[model samples]
Target: MKSGQLNRRVIVQRATSVSDGAGGQVREWPEIGRPWVKASLWSTGRGAGGGQSAVADVMQDNQAFVIRMRPRDIATGDRIVLDGLNYRVRAVVDPNGRRRELQVSIELEVPENA
Candidate 1:
């Protein structure tokens, strides 16, 4: 992967359980690392009816993205944050199998209301 292609900076976070001070643990996403990555829009999908509007129709948006960066300890449960949006990691792949680079597949889901 070319360094020039890594034009975007993103934050990687991992889920952790922290004491909530009420005798229970609360889930939290803590920043793990900030890395420069090459991000590409993989795909996008919208709600049914292909943009038809209806009161019962709930708009669902699924955006898939692929990021390439140097090999790291990223995992499936980890998340990538870009532009203040959180993306769930779906898959990780080492294309060349040489550990030189990693291709991570991440996705974001948006509801109609928000």
Candidate 2:
């Protein structure tokens, strides 16, 4: 039998600002946590980004992402359908090794306007 899919909670963090020990401040020194991220892996493939250099150079692309539902309802390797849109899961990774949090990247089928 095939294994059942599971859903997990993940937090997305972005750099912010905070006070230093000496009552000073710095950029990219603080991070704010975004809660309630729901996504699942649809499929996996060779990373898309590449560069030509002295040696064969390649880099892992941001995992394609699609928000499946509001609040939270998705799992690893599950196709996400959000707002009538679709995205694929690349992978979930730890953020910066500063704290234990999962970072998920999703590639939008259609780009959004800011």
Best by TM-score: 1
* Reference-based TM-score of each model: 0.79, 0.28
Which one is best on lDDT?
Answer: 1
- Against the unseen true structure, what C-alpha lDDT does each candidate score? 0.75, 0.37
Cα deviation of 79, candidate 2, in Å? 1.9
RMSD of each: 8.4, 15.7
Tens digit per residue, CA lDDT, model 2, 1-114: 011221533343333466777999864412223234545442334332221111112113433442222323223433334444444333444434443344444554344563
Q: Stretches of candidate 2 above 4 Å error? A: 1-35, 38-76, 96-99, 108-114
Cα lDDT, model 1, residue 51: 16
Clashes of each: 0, 8
Give me candidate 1's TM-score against the actual structure. 0.79
Worst 10 residues of 1 by lDDT: 50-59
Instruction: Report the C-alpha displacement of residue 57, candidate 1, in angstroms.
Output: 27
Instruction: Give the per-residue Cα lDDT of candidate 1 at 63.
Output: 69
